[model samples]
Target: MKKNKDIEVRIEETKKTISGSTYDVTELYIGKKKIGEVLAYGPKEFQSFMDNEELGASKSLDLAIESIIRQWNLHE
Candidate 1:
């Protein structure tokens, strides 16, 4: 996918503990700012982590509106 100048995407892997349990972690960053994170058990963990509310919470109402604007501009 083509990268957008206004928004940057970054992904990193780390370790985290939840409820006294340790697991692998995957984090998403937008322009050097962390937006959300995900946790899982194995190779498919990254996919599983994305279903978390934290990822959804990253899409605020304002952000959604801004994204729509950007999309409209690109199409035009």
Candidate 2:
């Protein structure tokens, strides 16, 4: 995929407590400078699979970008 100059993507491991068990999840960040509600790689897609699975940083970024592009197309 081509690089996007307007948006920045970052992913990191996050720990959350669920049923008293610590779970690690891959968190995807896009356009940190523009903060607000986002749909890319959001809970709707991420939580569809099993929880606590390791999603590579690049994979997360790619997925987020793809989602954003698809959403952008819908508005066009």
Candidate 3:
């Protein structure tokens, strides 16, 4: 399995708000490919979405990355 360091993340600052809040949605990427998106409210608060599915919220970005990799069956 690939670790967080192995994945390249690119955050796109969107002007759209989430849940009626001002939180921005950031897109996750590995190299030139987008893997998922995250609605990050804080450092320990975020909601991850991938493959047109909501992967839910979590406290750690590492956890979110791991889940994305696992759910997508990505290999190093």
Candidate 4:
């Protein structure tokens, strides 16, 4: 776990395939602990995630970060 101040967003290659295609995965980490990942790399892929996940936040990035922090109990 981390203070969230050390939160990092990183991109890496993966052999995993999604929807019959493969993309460089983006991962979120708090210090050394990985919290989440996104299989989408482009705008279309991101939109796919939003649609499939049914995320309705107007500010998706902010909401995603906040959600992760909240789940990690790092909002304190």
* Reference-based TM-score of each model: 0.46, 0.37, 0.59, 0.40
Clash-forming residue pairs, model 2: none
- Candidate 1: C-alpha lDDT: 0.49
What residue runs in model 3 are displaced by over 4 Å at the alpha carbon? 1-15, 74-76
Top-scoring candidate (TM-score)? 3
**lDDT (CA) for every model shown?**
0.49, 0.41, 0.71, 0.46
Question: Best candidate per lDDT, number?
Answer: 3
lDDT of 3 by residue, 35-65 (tens): 8876777879977889679988889866766
Enumerate residue pairs that collide in model 3: none
**TM-score ranking from best candidate downward:** 3, 1, 4, 2
Q: List residue ranges in candidate 2 displaced over 4 A.
A: 1-6, 33-76
Better of 1 and 3 by TM-score: 3
Clashes of each: 0, 0, 0, 0
User: How should the candidates be ordered by lDDT, best one leading?
Assistant: 3, 1, 4, 2
Model 1: per-residue lDDT, tens digit, 17-38? 8789988666666567555565
TM-score of 3: 0.59
How far is 40's C-alpha from truth in model 3 (Å)? Answer: 0.9
